[model samples]
Target chain A: MRVTVNGDPRDVPADCTVATVVAEAGVAPDERGVAVAVDGDVVPRSRWAATPLNPEARVEVLRATAGG
Target chain B: MLDPRPDDLVIAGVPLTSRLLLGSGGFTRLDRFERALEASGSELVTVALRRVEQAPGGLYDAIERGGARVLPNTAGCYTAREAVQTARLAREAFGTDWLKLEVIGDRRTLLPDAVELLRAAEELVADGFVVLPYTTDDAVLARRLEDVGCAAVMPLGSPIGSGLGLRNPHAIALLRDAVSVPVILDAGIGTASDAALAMELGCDAVLCATAISRAREPERMATAVRLAVEAGRLARGAGRIPRLDHAQASTSDAGIPDLTPAP
Candidate 1:
């Protein structure tokens, strides 16, 4: 199966869930302020592990950034 | 016969208990911003997004811990298309329709471009986004924005990040009367007194960043602004008693005879 993380397309195992996709990206679970969106809808942190990934899924993870 | 206490200031169905709106930028650090936000008692705070690197850890944990409604802003965009697209991206990231629309026209002053502001506001409102345009202190422009379905119109007290304080109270007051929607006095606030003055002039809320974030004691200033906003709101609610020029003597024909020793 294939999934896109943060606009970079990559191939991952078929059993991967959204949490697995992020874990593959190397972000630790204890890290804070990270939000994930799949297909333009936010996948709340609590549900990330349970939500399965799709082959054509487009996921974007954003952290709080600085601005004026 | 009497009105109930004013309802919670709701923007796009988000309940904001605090009238003082704080920005999530320009702090000494994220922890500083978080502490200042807590001190201010602000229920709605602004965060910005750019096409830049994402931090290793998430950036929104502290803000979420502050227990405020997260309102992402398009502060860096200069065009309608970019602002609109950013708004959509924010909705996707935060899963909230609330947005702080900022369309800057010039870099020197960071003033809002009224033309692009209206364009972006109209587009966002049509697409089911709760658009809050950071605008100028123009009454005519404010009316036009309300007509376009803006949830709130934020007119600057002065240029962004200037902190020069309320430059034109009359114009802000005019904007207040001219629009039926919430009129937020955005930017140019330097101190707690400034925030109080804006609310006294009938602004529904005040949005400021540098005033508190750059202060010598950021958290202290934040608490001051919070009290100032509340004092102003209470004063407005109490209504000002008109002044009288001449003093009138009190009279009671049946009383005060004893003061003359029955003479």
Candidate 2:
């Protein structure tokens, strides 16, 4: 299946979950301060492994940065 | 120094002693940001959300170590939908509903789109977020934001990072008087005097970043802003004398010797 991760399109294996996609994106499993949202809805960390991604789903992985 | 009135600044039921809200941006290094944050004595600090790869390493940790509560902002969003989505993402990332809502209307001025801002504020408020909107210094708009159940209304003194100071003191004062929620003077503060002026004009607090972070000595500027805020608050409470066209002599004419030449 094809999915867009952080505005970049990529092909992932079938039945890929958010956790797998995150891991494939080089984000360590223990990485702190990261939040993931699928199709504009937040996916809690506990549900990442169970939440399946649809084809062409927009996954936004965000973290806090310095700002005003 | 006089202690700030206990429970004076209550935003969304969170009591804060410091009227200066610092922004954790523009600092060249984490150590300096830490020093500036410590010196500012701000209990509430603002942070922004971005892509994971763009996240500043150790910035959140430093903010935590400084012992201030974080108020994540949707700074770069340009629409109601984008702002709402960003707020949710920020809430998820920070584990807090406190948001500094910003929906930019234009690229050049970086002004808030009042229409989109109100739309986003209404949605966020309905979603149980403590919305503190960054709005223009317009009294009616401030009231409209308060009507949508915003925790506070943050009016810009001028454009962001302009360092032009309070461009419309009357408008800020009007908003301060018109809204029941806290009126925080956000952005366009150039120096300590600007912060002081904002406070003196009846603002509950002043939020700033570039003024301090971009200064040659950020830590020192932070201290100055803190003191200036305190002084301004005290002065406001003290009730300044009314302005007059003519000067009034401080010395008593009767006590002075008659050394002047006879008329």
TM-score against truth, every candidate? 0.77, 0.94
- Which pairs of residues clash in candidate 1, taking residues 3 or more apart in a chain or in different chains? A32-B58, A33-B58, A34-B58, A64-B59
- Candidate 2 ranges beyond 4 A from true positions: B1-7, B259-263
CAPRI tier of model 1: acceptable
lDDT of 2 at B21: 97
Candidate 2 clash pair list: none
Considering only chain B, report the TM-score of each candidate against the true chain B: 0.88, 0.95
DockQ of every model listed? 0.25, 0.72
Q: Which lDDT tens digits does candidate 1 get at residues B1-263?
A: 22334656766655677888988667747777888989999878888764224442334667778888778889878999878877877776677788999999999999998999999999999999998899999999999999999999999998888888899999998989999888888989989899998999998888878888889989999999999999988887788867689865567556555555654
**C-alpha RMSD of candidate 1:** 6.8
- Give TM-scores of chain A for all candidates: 0.90, 0.90
Kindly list the per-residue Cα lDDT of model 2 for residues B1-263, writing each as its tens digit. 33446736988877888899998878768898999999999988999887776775677778888999889999999999999988888887778899999999999999999999999999999999999999999999999999999999999999999999999999998889999999999999999999999999999999989999999999999999999999989899999999999999878888677788989
RMSD of each: 6.8, 2.7
